[model samples]
Target: MSDAASTGFSADWLRQREPFDLAARSASLALGFRAALGPQNPAAFRIVDLASGSGANFRALAPLLEKDQEWRLVDHDPLLLAAQRSEITRWASGQRWHCHDHEGGLAIHAGPARWLVRSQQLDLARDLEDIDLASCDGLVTTAFLDLVSAAWLDRLSALLVRTPRPLLASLTVDGRRTWFPTRPADQLIADAFLSHQGGEKGFGPSLGVRATPYLAAHLAVAGYQVSTQSSDWHIGREHSDMLLNMAQEAATVATETDPSCKPAVSSWLADRAADIHHGLLSLEIGHLDLLAVPHFPVVK
Candidate 1:
């Protein structure tokens, strides 16, 4: 489960899901970004990543954006922020990028592209406006919207109003999780998990599945043209660890929702575990990727 309330974020989960997030994000949106940036502005591309978890969004989008880039990764978790530098270095080494530790950030050169990544630990709820969006060329986030409230979205919209920028928000859970070969307690557990998604993640009454629409509407009102694409995670039986973690998270939430459901949930977990062990279980998780481009005032 990507949602932090249950399984939460571990190094294991982040590592497991990174490649899936990269593969599932809308490639066309990268084209949109290139077009938005245009060939004229060939100097520097500055982007701020919100709720950055170990810099997965950075690792995904950097190579795609063939430009000299600067990224400011923001998150509330100091521990995650601390991991950013090491995680990025490890990723760079794997890609065989010429990496160097710069004063303000990590400097890396891959083929013709150069990227500098920096980490910031900030309380986004308190400092959303405090972020210097006008200086940024774009904004990006992944697997984050479902954990925030409508009010938080409103604050974001208001900020975007001041300085219109291209935003690529990806991998948000849209409330669909399918366990293959079907189980009897699937719906009950799924319902409780969804309920937990809406509870709170430091933000009030998280929109969960309902977040995408609210965020889209707010962006539209702020003079942004919004587009969406499905960025679902299809977990096959081969990836046993993630599947097991997700199953465990589901049972945890279900039992918490209704204590009496423990027996039923336990049986469900056992069945799911066996299916996973035998490589029989598969999962389809619904997620949405939203691209918002501000309609800049046409100069007469």
Candidate 2:
């Protein structure tokens, strides 16, 4: 796999998508994960975020969690891990939270809440077992599941069952793509995009759209009570930049998948670009948020 694929996503792409990711996440599911953590020392609620790109998952989820949060943001890319502190600091400052270095990590104070975040650069494909899941109150990942293979998920399932904890996996692609002012080429583009998604992404052949369903089923069989909710992105005309990126990416992938489709993809791209320019384009990309908790007494 290429460095970009193996190391993880670029900070810029992650930044561009952060708002959409945050907006589309299921707040109810997040709150449920928080409840599953049960009561703990307000000063020591730990969470392990796998493939944490630029710490957006931490930012999106921290406030929704307990007042005191300790997050281990794990990723393979040193650059992304390195960028975490500044990104987090800027975000904290914007929120009017006091952010400072503490114990080789960042300590953020949001009113009465305290959050400590530490970045760990470990290739999840090799060092997933190295993570001390038992020590953390919960496990959370965003926009990561689809890139993993079934074998990897099986390993994760076994690990989770061995040391049970609530898991909130959000924004997993579910293979649905809807474009406004429908065109026949949309189906063609969607099919090619899904095909491209199944290619190796540093995890053998990726599960792609099948990721959430497969993980949910495995976790359920392991006696986890899993619930899923739609977290689709509803991109409107105002999000022309995002729309353009989506169109270009789709065209590129579609052409790569089948050279014969290049002409069609080029024409489709032209039409999409025109639509975006005219403020007539909108899109909906399907995603799912899954919360899996061990079957335990309900927490009110």
> In terms of lDDT, which candidate is strongest?
2
After superposition, the stretches of candidate 1 with alpha carbons farther than 4 Å from their true spots are 1-4, 298-300
Which pairs in model 2 have colliding backbones? Answer: none
What lDDT does each candidate get? 0.84, 0.88
TM-score of 1: 0.95
For model 2, residues 24-119, the per-residue Cα lDDT tens digits are 999999999988887564546789999997999999989887488899999998888998998999999999999988999999999988899999
Where model 2 places Cα greater than 4 Å from the true spot, the runs are 1-8, 40-43, 296-300
lDDT of 1 by residue, 1-300 (tens): 356444257655788788778778888976686566553676778889999989999888888887899999999887788888889899888888888878788898988888988898888877888788877888899988888899998988887887777888898889998999799899998899888878877778889898998899889877888999898888888889888988887888898888998999999999999999999999988899999988885111
Clashes of each: 0, 0
TM-scores, one per candidate: 0.95, 0.95
Q: Output the TM-score of candidate 2.
A: 0.95
**Which ten contiguous residues of candidate 1 have the minimum total lDDT?**
1-10
